[model samples]
Target: MLIVGEIHTALLPHSRPLTPEEARGALALAVGETVVQWARPVPHTASPTLLHGVDCRLPLGPKPGNRHADDAAGGSSVRAVGTVCSRAVLTGGHLLQGSAWTAVAPPQQPRRMPWSYYLARPGTLETIGNFEARRLAEGYLLADGQGKGLARKVRHDGGTALLDAAAIARHSVHDVLSRPVLDQRPPIKTGSTRLRWAAIADPGEGRAVAFRLVGNDRRRMSLVTGLVEPEQIAAAAEDLAVHDWLLSAVAARIALAKIGEDPRHTLRTLRPVVDHLLHLWSAGARTSRDLEFMWDSLERRPGLTRQWTTMTERVRSQIDYGAADLAAKMLDMMEERQKQTGGAGEPHYR
Candidate 1:
């Protein structure tokens, strides 16, 4: 079985973090389903699972000798039928995430199954023909408009492809973003982070996860684990996406400042980090034991928190310098005016 998923992370549009009650209302996307909330690690709220039925050709990568052979394109196009799992999450009641993924299993029958059959197995996609976990995962994570050619064609012809997990996640985020509950004033001026992950079933290998920073835009990760469920993998990926977003968002803000720009304006730009984003760097807060290793591996090599601290300190120093510089300039101006006025008496205001 191959489990593939994508996560979209962004700041909640609200001026202030939403309370548990507000988050519940914001995440109410389905009937008879409850949004789960946890308070200890962070004020986290998750919408109930949303499923999208997918019945289209599996996207295969191009093969060396043959032009249209790989699983990404499927020489002639092999269809994969299954339900994609999606959900929205609020972290610290401030960050919002739309996550979707599907587990691909070889179909029990030789042909397309009934919709009821797919619906019965939520979050799983049954493919009719050849299914290669690595190729599918790579194709899904390929940079925008790259490996999507085959997947796009299948969706175009078949009307729906289970492999379009990213689309489901993007739409979920858009739904929350359009709601009136969130204020128009954005908290941080940053772009959203897209993370794609695939967990390939590894019999007796225990659980090990690998993280890769791909194409300078997206983060891709893979998990080779023993018998772990897909939902658990999705949750871990969600957590990773959130923290990774926080880091990337902060870094982008820092990089946007021009050395020659007005210090006050730069201060204004960095203020959001302190006010809204600094307290959001909690890693592995809600990760499951099976996926904790993934977080640990990433933290060790990239040292996410370490980099965050360095950036935070830099921002804080700049803010302090800006404040002091402004104060010194004001004082100098007052002294110059005093000299020009020959130390005149204090003026009275109405």
Candidate 2:
């Protein structure tokens, strides 16, 4: 079984963090579906899972305008139909994420099936013809030059338009960000990040996760899970996406600070880093116990939390140094004026 999904993460477009009530009201996506809220280590809220239908071609190659050896491995033509599950997640009442995913399994019959058949099985994309799951995963992760769907396949290759699950996921995020519930006045301006993940069920009781970064705003994750459930695989993917987004966002802020240029300016630039981002580094806090090994393995090799701790310390050191430098300059100006006038007097500083 192959489970593919994408997550879009960004700061909630509001001046201040939302209260639990406000968060709940904003996340009401499905009719009569109550939103879930958690107020433990930090304020969190999630919308009920909603399903959207998709009927389109599954892309062939990893990228558009090119072909790989595996591009010709699948059937001559392939079409898929199913529902993609999506929802909005709010962490610490400030960070917002929109996630969408679908499971790709082998074709049940030689020909296509009815819409109701696919709809009955939520989050399962039914392929009409034979297709290689591994090839599909690669095509989705690489996507296109724009990280959208394969625009050329429908016309050039004589196939239907690519299904583009990532685009569907991104659209879900835009819908949430544009809602009237948000004031649209974010405290700080940071770009959004996207993570595309594919999890393959293995034949054992052990799991492994691999993460890779492409350029800056895009990420790809491949998971080998012992579990067969699509929901559990989706949960692990979402958890990884959140942590990766936080790290990327904070690192960008650090670069924007431009330390040593102007102490006060750097401090002003990083104020949001301290208030909104520093406290949200709780990894594996929301994941199930069965999936803890994935995080643990990451913590051992790449050391995600270690990087965060180092970055937090760096932010604090800059704050301390800036304050000390400002104080020293003030004291020097004041003392020199006193020496000249033989009495304490108001000092002017550049």
Q: Which portions of model 1 miss their true places by more than 4 Å?
A: 61-77, 143-162, 259-261, 340-345
Among all windows of ten consecutive residues in candidate 1, which has the lowest summed lDDT?
A: 143-152
Q: Per-residue CA lDDT of candidate 1, range 17-124, in tens?
A: 888998898888887998899987678899889877666555655554664455343343347876788899999888999998888887688878778988888888
Tens digits of per-residue lDDT, candidate 2, 1-350, equal 77888888888889988889888888887779989888977787888888877776665553354565445234333578778888888898888888888888778878777778888998888887776766677766655333335122344556566656667676657767767878889888888888888877766635778889887888888877765577777777777888888888888888988899999888888888898888887888777777788899999979999998998899989988988999999999878889997786765679
* Model 2 stretches astray by more than 4 angstroms: 60-68, 72-77, 144-158, 204-206, 332-350
- Per-residue lDDT, model 1, residue 69, is 51
Q: What is the lDDT of candidate 1?
A: 0.77
